[model samples]
Target: MSKCIQGLSLGVLCLVLVSTISGALSHEGSVALSHEGVGRKQNVTYDGRSLIIDGRRELFFSGSIHYPRSTPDMWPDLIAKAKEGGINVISTYVFWNAHEPVEGKFNFKGRYNLVKFIKLIQKQGLYVILRIGPFIEAEWNHGGFPYWLREKPGIIFRTDNQPFKYYMKRYAKMIVNMMNKNELFAPQGGPIILTQIENEYNNVQQVFKERGADYVQWAGNMALKLNTGVPWIMCKQKDAPGAVINTCNGRNCGDTFTGPNSPNKPSLWTENWTAQYRVLGDPPSQRPAEDLAFAVARWFSKHGTLVNYYMYHGGTNFGRTTSSFVTTRYYDEAPLDEYGLVREPKWGHLRDLHRALKLSRKALLWGTHSNYSLGHQLEARVYQNSEKNVCSAFLANNNTREAATIYFQNVPYYLPPRSISILPDCKTVVFNTKKVNAQHNARTFHHVKDFSKGMRWKMFKDSIPNTEDTPVQNSLLLEHYNATKDTTDFLWYTTNIDVGSNDLPLLNSIKPILQVASWGHAVHGFVNDLYVGSSHGDHVQSPFSLNKPITLKPGKNKISLLSMTTGFPNSGGYMEHKIAGVSKVLIQGLMTGTQDLINNIWGHQVGLLGEKLEVYNPRSSKKVKWVDAKGHDHEPLIWYKQ
Candidate 1:
């Protein structure tokens, strides 16, 4: 061959080579293979009888771990830990706001390198379950939807509304197209066998009413049209419509609660809330490790072929992403803490439990389950294969603080309080939730430096203080706008008011309320330079409310309300249009029955001057003076004593 032809042919051959390896199936089966690069989609089939991986029967175990929750440097270690815990697949939701913070712009570098993440999983000999929720409600801010979508006029989320559908389809296509280029689907020989759409829609189904169901069906249709050759799933969606497999998402998911409308589909647990979330002002909510093991063993004994722990490792919320409804600290008490440290007994105990479950893979993946009551909240379930050659058992005590010993086939098995024991061999008890055999490693947290002794401080005039002449948007009535990919929790509202001594007492009489309907990541109020109040709402779905009646005296009073958001609302009905800035503020009894300030021309600013200067960490600022503020945005903003 000529040198030119040889080079051209060589280039084509290299392209083909990458495509072939990138899209290789796990098992030899009928799943079609795509000649695209890794991350492409291929048709996949699950015939109720078997997963039919590449046309062959296979058993799979998966776990959930969000990428952004942990640093990219920690991915390999986390994945290794998961594999050690008997996981054959890694699952994650592609956070929308994290990827496309601004409209039409995309950032997949560094920690957001999703393609790299998937490739890393494949390297670890595991499959991937990509949940492209564009609308993931992972207790995250705004449920993972982009803030920019809210900017669109008349846009309703998770509905049959045209605007929502258009945006949803657009995002879906973007993902599919990106993956297609890489051939990430099973047919393409990549590890991705399953993909999901619209996370836990069923959790909020009642809120959608008729429009919700229609929206779900529409989402399903759009997913199918993508034809990625993988089984599409809808987690916690009861009304998922035809061909859309509805999967369970919770601490315990069993086959007993199969969807009435989709009986033909297989039962899968997409999220197993292994450990609960802990918040400040509340007692820790740690499930005894034994209970988690028991739950898994129960699922296996009850013919559950697939069970995914909601958070195999709940990593840190980090940066400004720490969401809260009230002023409470949230700790998941998971296998891993925010700092990437192992969560002692919980982690080790569950690791052992995974081993016990894996030992009974044969009986679990293909067996008939039968349950029998052993009395006293004690229950026994047996899984026997078609040939009766494989047998596994589970003994559970449902009581929160009781132990039970049950006889199975004349054999006695001891189960601890609120625990379950798994016997893969039907002879030896391997895993139990309540009984802990692992070492407990305690955690300690200390402030970097104690401010009790006090430190030197300085004060400077805030360039962007609540002042007159600031620009404000005029809205006669309440209006909510989307983030439009602007991820900052900050929105500025400035308005001038003429007040006097008589007006002040009148305002105090009627309770001059700062009724801001702000769906902020957090909210702060300022009357001129004096700080009013600040509040951080619930992390999952928190909005600020400055309901305190402020005493505003006479002479030009400048009211500045700052609404800060961690990220944009990503899920829920019309969440895209949820009000983020100061929605309503009333200075009642100013003079008449109600002198509502809703009609005042309000100046709007997107973010803080410090943020604009990229001054996230004050320690690194040599030129800037740091001062300890008595209270954050306190009324008559007090400077901390130097």
Candidate 2:
């Protein structure tokens, strides 16, 4: 056999070998991989015009639907919806934080069951794109790295630093090993075909510095070294090394970027954003179905082959896992809301457009192309093979709201505002974003009542006394605690010291200056049961000053702080040592000039009474005047009932 054939045959052999090994290796039952090496061995051909999948050059449609975004119960329906919308693949990011909440602990029993999720996709007869971004920054908290990582010492993230590489390699191995053991690769007849490493690194490429290049190289090498026998992709990574294929992302990419290396590598759009995420104070933003369809048309007419909708079904950000906490994680302007209801117009309009675009599959998937810019933001393109068997055409207007007419090779075409025109036969305009031909359907679900609707409430003072037991002799005597196996956001540090009559004046009038250190993303303070205030951190560091006046009742007073985290520090630079709690809580109102109380004998507490009660769930709800259900819109102690 020739070397090429031998290599190809070995590839095939490795596929079966891996699958067989996986089947035997699985602690559970055997896992399946889809047609992994078949496309390669079949001599898949492609140009600027078409993608030949399984020996046939054809147009392919894909959509993004991360399994972690929704529950397994919702998977079948979401996949069915995508297929109904004319999608061929299910793209997702394997959230590392969700999978590994603690350092060595992994829980894939429920929603974190990536294996089951992939198997479910395969059962639906759909392809899969597994984006294993140990560093996925999908508007996720701490960019999806667990807060436990932030507890580590001197561990800078996404760099060539020894600590980071150590953890990154360990995590990558855990995931790859799981997938391989289950034969989740294509060689194992599983649905996954494409795999991604990291996410949008190019968007933050400047942050990596010179080490960025080396870090990219290290990531690619580590990922490829797994020998998954499938291609690895990096989005927005224009300078990706030879081993990793760099792909595109954005509202429009086919016209703006080209393949970094071999044309054999197909054009893949990783994130075709359907709508923008919601921001505070901004009205809910949405993309009209027509504009979205027009963008797809432009890509198809330009000989683009693979297009994945950034999110065919936008799922909810359940729990604190949603992006906004201090900012606003309640972003639900997706094609589908957090409740799984499809957004109007954009959903139906895009559905019909997907069907129409599919009709041009042959012309789009096969023919080579030529482009003609008709000027004035209007462009034209023609695609066909020399055999004269297949042809397609595209017309588009870049203007946001102006309509135009342009003659392309003697054929008059009408371009709508910010729209694209697709012609499967180079004659008829079959799909236009400006036009809608599908029925718009709206879905809404009844809200479930509180889980703690009828529970009782009881408050007991914690036995630990106060922070005065140990008076600091100097400013440098403050202490820090590391939360190890104890992963809750709460940490308690209490000490006590006496203040004589002279010292009483300094502390009483001294504003009771207390400085605290904690890794909690959110911290609440209390002095003798009086609510001091609450301070929240951004993506990093829980640094703030409690300028509120604190009084000492003659002898001793209890000072408590409750720190909470939406999710632990999962990944970053020196993330392990990322100080989250009150790094420095100063009583600055009492002191001025150089004598500020940035440091003091601090009594720190990690969590709140509400958290210990698990107040978020109704099953833990109790009846207390200050804590019981009032109405939904009340403040402070307000609770809601069924």
Candidate topping lDDT: 1
Each candidate's lDDT (Cα)?
Answer: 0.65, 0.61
- In model 1, the runs with Cα more than 4 Å from the true position are 1-44, 54-59, 259-264, 278-284, 320-331, 386-388, 399-402, 446-461, 464-468, 473-487, 499-525, 532-554, 565-571, 583-601, 617-642
Error of 2 at 186 (Å): 2.4
Q: What is the C-alpha RMSD of each candidate to the true structure, in Å?
A: 12.9, 11.2
- Can you tell me which runs of candidate 2 are displaced by over 4 Å? 1-52, 147-154, 255-259, 278-283, 323-331, 409-411, 441-465, 468-486, 489-522, 535-546, 549-555, 567-578, 588-598, 609-642
Candidate with maximal TM-score = 1
Q: Which tens-of-lDDT digit does each residue in 248-338 have in candidate 2?
A: 8888776776764565566777878887655334566677677677777776666566787877766766555654342233325555666
> Candidate 2: TM-score?
0.78
Question: What 10-residue stretch in candidate 1 is worst by lDDT?
Answer: 12-21
What is candidate 1's local distance difference test score? 0.65
